[model samples]
Target: MKALRHVLRATTVREAIDRVPEAFYERFAFAFLLAWLAAPLLLWWVGPVIGTDITFLAWVNLQVGLGALILVALRLAAHLVPPRDVSWRVVLRDELPLVLLGMFLLLAVLATALSPTAEALDGDWYRRESIWTFAAYVGFFFLASRVVSGVLRRALLAGVIALALITCIVTLVAAISAGWHTDEGAVAHRAIAYFHQFNHYGYLLAVACVLAAAAALTVARRVLRGGLIAVFGILLLTLLLNDTLGAYLAVVAGLAGLVTWLAVLRRLHVTTLLLLAAVAVVVHVLADALGVGVAAEIASLGGDMVAVSEGSADAASAGTGRWGLWMITLEQIAVSPWSGHGIEGIASLLPGGYGRPHDEYLQYAVFFGIPALIAYVSAVVVVLVRVVRRGRAVDGITVCATAAAFAYLISALFGNTMYYTAPLLFLLLGIAWAGVRAAGSELLDAESTPLAEDRTAPTPII
Candidate 1:
């Protein structure tokens, strides 16, 4: 009888745990946001120590797994205590591309299963796992945007800005401490500033620069503006010192797009342009003042540019060597043109066994086939069309998001930024979606206010 009573008590506890309120479950959204924010930083710090065990890809997987778990828990709770209206519209609208992409990949993998070449391909456990990671991150962002309150939404934006600012500051300090050099001499060695590759460091600085610039424009407080300007100066300095052409070009294009969008919306005040100019001048003066080898660093950057130009020429002369890979991939696509190679099969079928196609468009076509590529393209086109249609009138968020998307899209032409960097892309997408939602909410509020006022007003029944 005692044992029976204990079993009943255990069952009671389990029931209580399962009955946790939806409000309590909502904390998972915040948890997922925090995990997303911390992932890049953790990878930067611990990656070297742990080697491939904790790579950027691995960190992404962890965040995705946590996000998926939270999403599942939230869905389960929602079923128990349903929302007023559970619309799958946002999921279907925002996530169709990802779903299609996944299907394409699966088909490609299956088609390649019988091929002997698959054994010689660059298949790895991590690469295989990345597809799910990509899907989860995309799904989580879409769901979170739909469910999170405005206050939480702003908090997430603030977190992104704060991270950008911190990264900028670190890069600037590293550059200053390293000191400069003359045209003939080398600059002092500097720390990598939490990134493994120089290109990654440059990319981070470029992004931070844009975020800082946006903050300087939209943030109202004087003190905050000044702080943002200071941070922007530091990030600009870091970018110049790093001298990565891709980073430099991306920032220039992003900032130009932001400024143009703001101007088009009539949101660009004279003071904003003046402040931007002032920041640029201040950065230049600071670089000169350091005198720690500024000229030499400039020369180094020039040399690097020349070398890159030469390399491009060499690649062009060699017919990119990618053409051969492309042909092989096309042949594979012909075998299963509807699905392509399979989700993970393209990488497994490279003629010379290259890990990545290096071209994302090709990667998609090779892995998913023509049908999947068409669906993927259509999905992006739909989102682009929706966002553009709605965002014809500009606002702060729209301007920033539009610029971010433009930069990402342009960069995607050269690198497979979308495949590995889905979070970044989806973050921009979420911002655009949130902006649309906010606009609709404001319109509803405006419309309801007059109705409420009319209903409450004193009326005489004669």
Candidate 2:
């Protein structure tokens, strides 16, 4: 017992953290945010110019390069600013998503270990690799949010908007050069920049569009709002060119959530909807002039949606193959209802030419078993519920975050977004935490600080 007590002690870890200044957490958070923002640009600009597609490698480089920089910044922050301690309760509360994510990852890893792959290891790693990557972002961003005060949350959101703007710029350049095709396409569009597959790019843009729109709606500064709105237009055009129906549906769902929230608050009215319509019309005219074929895309998206609903095996199905693949996948899952084969377990079992489950909920159920799927959905549901329950009194940013999350959830129904736009959405989740936590801080400041005698009553918290 004595030896066990010594071995289990947390003194060493705490001592290491203690050596670092507490004030560094906020800076570390910002530095990490900046690193992520730099990654897509590194891939899109540097990759094409250098004749390489190192999108995944760029992600890895940011983790290594920026991670070290953050460590140095942490040391500097500790010394330069006053140090304070954070309680474990705070971490547990603010980082519950990550905690739940860790649990899911652990289950996935264990499942993979227990259910060894019978087939060759060619693509057996895809599912497992995605889960690992997802876990990394959740853990990294959760920690980033943990140390910083609510003060840095807005900066983090702005960082997201910056990423969206850059992505839109890269996407527009790539689409213009590559040109859009009305014919059948590959799994991911062929012309996407900074992402491997077309759907991946589509999903990213769709989520970014939501982010940009949210920012445009709430931002007080006209210049920033205009910039965001412009970015949203660019992103919308790119999404149209990609021709991903799932992404389109997801983006609309997110927008609806935002609109509903605004309407509930009496903020959404005819002028707002009319302005949105005008923006869409202006973008459509611009797209038509640019020769991107916006009208064809609208027709194609409608046709694809109809096919999916009717389960028609047509030209669209030849491209995505989602409806049919899902049918076979559900049958496969029925045999082994629980304790699904781990990781890329589904790929080998699936019929040839079908990429993945294509649905995240189905992927979770077939890959990690039903329990993991429940947990996965629960985590997302918790965020949506939390944001909704935060009430109209919270703030515009928080409401925006909720809208973005809802849009992503709607998209997740169609793709393994956990592998793509999900990381971005997870970052938004962290920002949401920051927004809520910041509000709480203001409340704390009001209660803790002593009021001057002249000001008998404290200022109302608007």
Candidate 3:
């Protein structure tokens, strides 16, 4: 039939998917990375535009299903390029974390199988998000790493800037919609905006702010840099308005990481420090005027943290509710500490007035067990070391990326943040992995050969 002919000609969706170019994987990865940045907001916008009511997490679940389809298409498209032969020795030396990751996943699956409530495997919301996200992260990381051409690498950075800009625009619209108020006691506020979830929006704002700030520092032109700085300032303002202590701590941790990395490399400058100090002063003055004691509260956290570390856990848990939940999680851990009882396994086991622990480490342990938790930490440490080793001084991406990673890491201590930040976090780490490897290779090449000075060098890609 004519219809079958058109389908056979790769005109249909199925055929088109099969015919996707190998290079499209990296491009698609970047595109999806951009979409993921504003997906919730996009979904929310579509409701008004199309006269439909689609909730945020529902949209996310649909995205997860589509992600599975993408994985299949990527696999089929991969057949276009000949596979490289990698020896066990080479893999062990270069990708031990990846190997460990496979083992960890295997353990997790086995743990889930061992769980009595099989329905929890899919019914558990956090479990579903974590697994799908991890799979997508692994697939995208490997795909992106394969095609690190100068153009692709450049696109990634530009894409990040573009994504940040889009975030700022959407955030402004959301803020304006909120009538520019924090509504401190109320749940709905400017910072919550499309994200609805306050803490996720808060930390996301922190990440965006640092990302904008770092990118601003890297630009050569003053006008564009100033604009980015303004955007970063707006993001800070949103964070201040949100007043989520965890998000505040996360952003501060990230900024601290950025400063520490630069300082250790001797790339930190006094002017930069003074500018940062000035920003802090401005933020404090504004917060004081607004009656938001964020700066003072942050100072108080120093003592609070000390108190918690010294066996007083009231301050350690964000609140009494969280403290009660954490106690229940500890009981669950004691019941099955080695291999976890499984995802959503704690729901029924939990006591009255208690809920899931806000802590992410506990989430991993509760669902996938202790070994999987260890594997996750090991993987993070490996990537951080790889990206940061003998680092590049001029590229603010590494510093920003590292800071972002640390922020997510610290933020997760207070809540299950990985679901919200996973894609962006892993994307940066993937780029960092490729960049670090390239930088290391260039260094080796330079050491092996005599490099002649050339003043008329084409401008390098940061």
TM-score of 3: 0.77
RMSD of 2: 8.2
Clash count, one per candidate: 12, 5, 0
- lDDT by residue (tens digit), candidate 1, 13-37: 5564444444343355656665676
Model 1: residue 271 alpha-carbon error in angstroms: 1.2
| Candidate scoring better on TM-score of 2 and 3 | 3
User: TM-scores of all models?
Assistant: 0.67, 0.76, 0.77
Q: Name the best candidate (by TM-score).
A: 3
Model 3: lDDT of residue 195: 56
CA lDDT for candidate 1: 0.53
**Candidate 3: tens digits of C-alpha lDDT, residues 338-398:** 7887766787766553335778788778877888878877777877886677565224444
The lDDT ranking, best first, is 2, 3, 1
